[model samples]
Target: MCLSFHSFRKLIASVLFLTFFFTGCKNSEKRTVKTEEITFIKEGELSIYKPGTDVPVLNLNIELAETDYETQTGLMYRTSMKENEAMLFIFDDVAMHSFYMKNTEFPLDILFIKEDMTIGSFQENAQPLDEGSLSSKVPVQYVLEVNAGIVAEKGLSIGDSISFQKL
Candidate 1:
């Protein structure tokens, strides 16, 4: 086929443009992914006390994860947690809550608490990045995620009550 010089140049330009566009979309592995730094803020102090006693079972500087987004992102990217640091997840009603360690970088002990703030159940030593469903087994209104072994270290039991104050 015979074509004018301008027409031939236009065809070449169009072909080059489409070639680069398709190739760019296919190279997903070369894409630059931007990851933001996750910040840890001590928003409150929570104390887990022995039931019916004034003695403290454990005290933690906590980050409150009450909203849907906050609760979903609870400690997922944290590399380390202070022995006295924790994340508290608050729900709107009392119900069974299941948690997994997806994207979590450190192990944790998840304490499921009843409506009255007493611990209902515990998921111990949840491994980092494990997608296993750690259910409360009973209805709960609150969840406390602390460093693994904190419960055993403090001798904390299911019936221990927790109280918190915002800072």
Candidate 2:
């Protein structure tokens, strides 16, 4: 077929435009995936205590999940946590530690804890779905997760202490 230069250029441009448009749409759709829930552990009781004031009067409700599944799920789907609410993650021993908010829906404050019950370090304002690893500044035996702003509200400091019991 014989065509003019202008017509040929127009045809090529149309082809290119459609190619780019469909490809762009497909890629965008892939990016807009619906996030699903990941259950880490089974249901159990967890209790939190202020590190070591020698007074065990006040305690908090924690979902105890020592197994891989329970610990992995953690508190990813919960919409709200109470003012006195906390999650105590227990490990077999104190070791180098890190955490990420992959499927989590709420912002959190993470407290890396030592065997002595002293605060190893604190990651305040942990963003939801953030994959960045919040590493412990020191080796930690346990990790306490609370609502993002709760740490400052409670006047919790890096050197502040914490403790827990499996109920």
Using alpha carbons, what is the TM-score of model 1? 0.78
In terms of lDDT, the poorest run of 10 residues in model 1 is: 28-37
- Provide the lDDT at 86 for model 1: 90
Per-residue lDDT over 68-163 for candidate 2, one digit per residue giving the tens place of the 0 to 100 score: 876787777766577567777888878888889987888999988888777779999999989998999798888888789877776677656655
Q: Which portions of model 2 miss their true places by more than 4 Å?
A: 1-59
Identify the candidate with maximal TM-score: 1
| lDDT per residue as tens, model 1, 8-124 | 999999999999998988886679887886777899999999877997877889999999999898888768888888999989999999999999999999999999989999988
CA lDDT, candidate 1, residue 70: 95
Q: How close is candidate 2 to the true structure, as a TM-score?
A: 0.65
Tally clashing residue pairs in candidate 2: 5
What residue runs in model 1 are displaced by over 4 Å at the alpha carbon? 1-36
